[model samples]
Target: MDHIFSPWRYAYVTSRKGDDGCVLCGIGAAAPSSDEESLVVARGDQAFVVLNLYPYNSGHLMVVPYRHASHLGDLDAAVLAEMGRLAARAEAVLVEVYRPDGVNLGMNLGKAAGAGIEDHLHLHVVPRWIADTNFMTVAGETRVLPEGLRETWRKLRGRF
Candidate 1:
């Protein structure tokens, strides 16, 4: 029997349309950082912090700019600075909540660069720790998340 099962999961599809609309543009500048549906962490004037609805780690989040830019080089300087600020805030929140030993901050540009959603340029902040990766990934082809998304969102949302 070849059955795929992802236990203990909750996901919010960020978007399915990218033909004419920009993922960053639709979310807006004044939207709540985390809505029950959207799972946003914090919102800034030029940036938005959102929990990765489908995450590598429970607290995984993306800091997205308000403007829609396909490439990293196209980002405005102000948005870049704001991204840094949001990154710092994300680190602080993760420390306060998960207290992970480390974190991974990155942006995968374009489809060739491993960007699953290439049209939306966003920075990913994934919390990490020693032994966080287990046999599930190495041998079982699965991941064991220590906490659920809702619990993580509750803990993280309180910080901001």
Candidate 2:
């Protein structure tokens, strides 16, 4: 049997049990000096772009508001507008960096709606390509990524 090793995920898997804070809010509040470590590529006045810790594909990112808000209606117009603008920018950056066939932008509002973080809202920007999904994800329940997170962050950080 072939084994897929993702050592980086160990930290998340181990720490998740004890973690009660909102991940998005923590990233949003992090200092600019730690942006690279946090995988934050860009920041707008009301929102910021950070790479998804676990991505569906390469260049998967999230646009999150600075304020902690669980629902769309909880945010003001300015925050919503900036998140949209940032999501658009993320799409452009993904196209330039990965050149995927298409892009997906979405928001999952609550636990019942498939939100991993139900208390803080975020917009997911994913880059999709032909045949990106494969048997490993279906049968083995594992994801195969071509590049490492730091490498992905390096490739995308400059463009944003």
Candidate 3:
């Protein structure tokens, strides 16, 4: 038998119980000193790349525009373009650092669409490998990530 200890996630799970405000906007507004804590990996002029604090995988990242817009129709063409560019960069960084079998990229437009933070638009860059999904996630309702978010940030931060 084996056990996975992720005590750091306790704070996140409990703290977000009834949290308000747009998380993406808050991260965008955070200062450089807060990068590690916020899990922001890279910042661009129009958009930025950040790690999902409660990630599906070890390198699950999100490319988000700085503007606080929920719908894709609300974003400017430049912001949309930059988001794509940043997604590409994120994929490259994930490949370089994690070397997964493949990657999953997507966006959830609204709460009904499975967007946890439906008020802020973000594209998820989730790295995947063969046989990565297991009983832990399906049967136990638990995710087994290979590495911690902070360590993943350290590996990907300089690359972006």
Candidate 4:
């Protein structure tokens, strides 16, 4: 019924860059992985937290190990524990801020398993709310979010 951002900016804002290279690797190089704009919330020795640029939801973040490996077997115990801990932390933060009714916490191992970036071992933490699904995603090929990425980041970062 009402609008927040301009309609003209919507395409550019929501549009994901479809280049002929590895997006995950590019993200790692683009910034220090600690900047909020880079979508890196918090990081430790073995792993780090990064927001999924192409997200299922606004607060969708990826908990990934510092080491670049494709499969779960490649990750060590520390890295695995780091991923698990970060996932739990992300869930708590999202719950505290957005109060989502449910969460989609898991990782797609391979391409067949729906791992968009299968080459990189990472876990996705997607926040889900009641009545979040709609025709926009099903029909319009989009997911209209209520808040901007910066706004969502600001709210979620406080919990970290």
What is the C-alpha local distance difference test score of each model?
0.68, 0.75, 0.76, 0.66
What's the number of clashes in each of the models?
A: 2, 0, 0, 0
Clashing pairs in 3: none
Candidate 2 per-residue lDDT over residues 1-160, each given as its tens digit: 0111111121332322213466676777777888888888998889999887777777878898988889899999999999988888899999998999998888777665667676888888888887776522523433677888899999998787
Model 2's number of clashes is 0
lDDT per residue for candidate 1 within 1-160, as digits (tens), equals: 0111122123222453233555455554334632644666677778888777657776888898877787868888888899899999998899888888888888777666666557778888888777666522523433556677678777887576
Predicted candidate 4 versus true structure: per-residue lDDT over 10-92, tens digit per residue: 12223222243544544554446446666667766677777665566778778878666898898889889878888899999
Q: Point out the higher-scoring one by TM-score: 1 or 4.
A: 1
> Which stretches in model 3 have alpha-carbon errors above 4 Å?
1-20, 135-142
Error of 4 at 41 (Å): 1.3
Error of 3 at 51 (Å): 0.6
Per-model TM-score versus the true fold:
0.78, 0.84, 0.84, 0.76
Candidate 1 collision pairs: 33-40, 34-40
Better of 1 and 3 by TM-score: 3
TM-score, prediction 4: 0.76
